[model samples]
Target: MIVPNREKQAKLRAFLAKEAHALGFAQLRVCRARDAQDREELLRHFINKGYHASMDWMEETLERRAHPSNLWADVQSIIMLGFNYGPDEDPRQLLARKDKANISVYARHRDYHDLIKGRLKQLSAKLLSRLRETHPEGAIKVFVDTAPVMEKPLAELAGLGWQGKHTNLVSREFGSWLFLGAIFTNLDLLPDEADKDRCGSCVACQEACPTGAFPQPYQIDANRCISYLTIENKGPIPHQLRSAMGNRIYGCDDCLAVCPWNKFAQQASEARLKARDDLKAPALADFLAMDDATFRQHFSGSPIKRIGRNRFLRNVLIAAGNSGLDSLSCDVMPHLDDSDPLVRGAAIWALGQISPDQDFAHLANQKQDQETDPDVKAEWHLALKGKTS
Candidate 1:
């Protein structure tokens, strides 16, 4: 039988860290594939409470997501990697600018899934090659955000960072802006000491939530989250939470931006992860006017493109309605007749917000007969009945 080699494993771990840094990872740590039952219990509790919203996939893949051993039984160690995508300025500063679309900092660049996955593969290959030289039976797997892996918990176990009250990993080195990836392998490696929670009496992340998404200090009600509402929910945004969304068209960053640990955060090291100039503060009117072709062209490599034009325009319409800029009425009016019922419904809601009651009544009457979609018809009825305020 092959014997365990502690010295060889230690050397390999150091080599892996060096390769990870060269591959653009900001931090790297390792942990055993076991010892994830507590996280699994937390996930089950969250799902049982219906906090996952419409994301049924979470329920479907619960077993595989709970622990790495269940995902790949032969896996002996999990390598957690972090890539910093921290912004140069405070993202919260744009919340007051109602005319500008507030896209989340992470979504402002090319998709991290693509950028980080490539690096993970390269690092995985390097580790696999090294392992094979010593043990021919060694095997490996790499995952970015695409998998159901509980990356946050695994990262914490690997001592990369602690999951703060906002539920995202908070790093002393990179704050709340690190992108996480994982490499699971059969090779035994030394695990790092898990990081302790540094969030003392501070509740800044909880109070900063525009929609009060956090039900408690560490619990998140995804259904009430702006990020889930704008990016995950495919239907009309809940009327109760629409006003709170303000001008945020994609994801909300209130909680992440308010973290106290961010004082140590640095701007993203990877140039590709940097925010594009046009996306920093795009006008709501310009975003609303983007048809499918234009939307794809502009956000070709962006995570925003995954939502498609209909869902994207739907979000833009909500931001326009909240903008309170009467001049944007010209931009919002055209979409009232948009082919997509979701877009048209959102446009009607936006119209009511910016237009006078008399003006909205006239427009509603004009569109009422032509609008056959039940959802769009409901929007017109709601606006005409003076129920939109």
Candidate 2:
């Protein structure tokens, strides 16, 4: 059981920071892996209140995710990394362009898990090599959101930032635009001072939520979250929430974009994380026309690709319906007959919104007789009655 001296540990920490910055990470800090008791209880409270929505995995991984030692018994330190993915402009600006799709700023480029995981592995390897010189038995493991790690809480404990009222980590330097990654190690390391909550008297994020996802300060109901509805949710968007979704075809950024701390946010230094020109406010008509092949090809390396064509088209149809562009009614009509019942249901609702009432009644009359799926039929029933919710 060899332990590195204080001077040696301090030198290693300095080396880790320098290398992390060189790799384009915005912030790096560490904390004892055991410093996670409070977060574990908070996670339990969130799950007990059903705030996790349909993401059952959160409950399934409760024990393993509660603390770092529960994940790896030998782990003694946790290193948290933050990368800035701040948008060049306010993402809320695109919401008014009803004819164009409003994609969340984070999903406009390459998938971040891939980008961050690759960098984490690189940093892990470099650190491992250095560790071998002092303690050959020392080992490290890296995670980038694919695992059950409580990254935000661990990051907060590591002095990266405090979790804002929106339940996302908020940084004084980068605001709500930081992408977090973690590295667990067997060697004990000096820990940084924890970042205290800086959200004093600010409910800007809460007020900005279009869905009113927050029931109280520092709490969220994922069932009403636009981000969860558009991304994690596998079924049709709730009828009542659809009208409020507006032109957001992918994940929503309203809460994050409105954070006051973002005034100090910097443009993403990593080119791959920056928004692509074509994805920045793409025409709703164009996305509504994408088939499986086109959607796959267009979003080849993007995070949006993971949601699949049918779901993507479903979101686009909701936007088209909300757009009030009668020109898009023709585009929405095709999706009404889509193979996926989810798409068909959303399309029915969209057409009912953009199409003439008489025309929609005529189409509903013709299609209701042929529709077999109970949910799709329900959509037709609701839409024909001129119901937006």
In terms of lDDT, which candidate is strongest?
2
Which parts of model 1 have CA positions greater than 4 angstroms off? 1-3, 387-389
User: lDDT tens digits, residues 29-49, model 1?
Assistant: 988886554457878999999
Consecutive 10-residue window with the lowest summed lDDT within model 1: 1-10
lDDT of each: 0.89, 0.90
**Sequence-dependent TM-score of model 2:** 0.97
Cα RMSD to the true fold for all candidates:
1.5, 1.5
Off by over 4 Å in 2: 1-3, 387-389
| Whole-model alpha-carbon lDDT for candidate 2 | 0.90
Candidate 1's TM-score reads 0.97
- Candidate 2 on 1-389: residue-level lDDT in tens? 23558888788888999999999999999999867763568789999999999999999998888888888999888989999999999999998999999999999999999999999999998988887766788788999998989888888889999989988999999989999999998878888999899999999989999999999988999999989998999999998899899999888999899999998899998999999999997999899888999999999999999999988888899999899999999888888889999999999988988888788888899999899999899888988877434
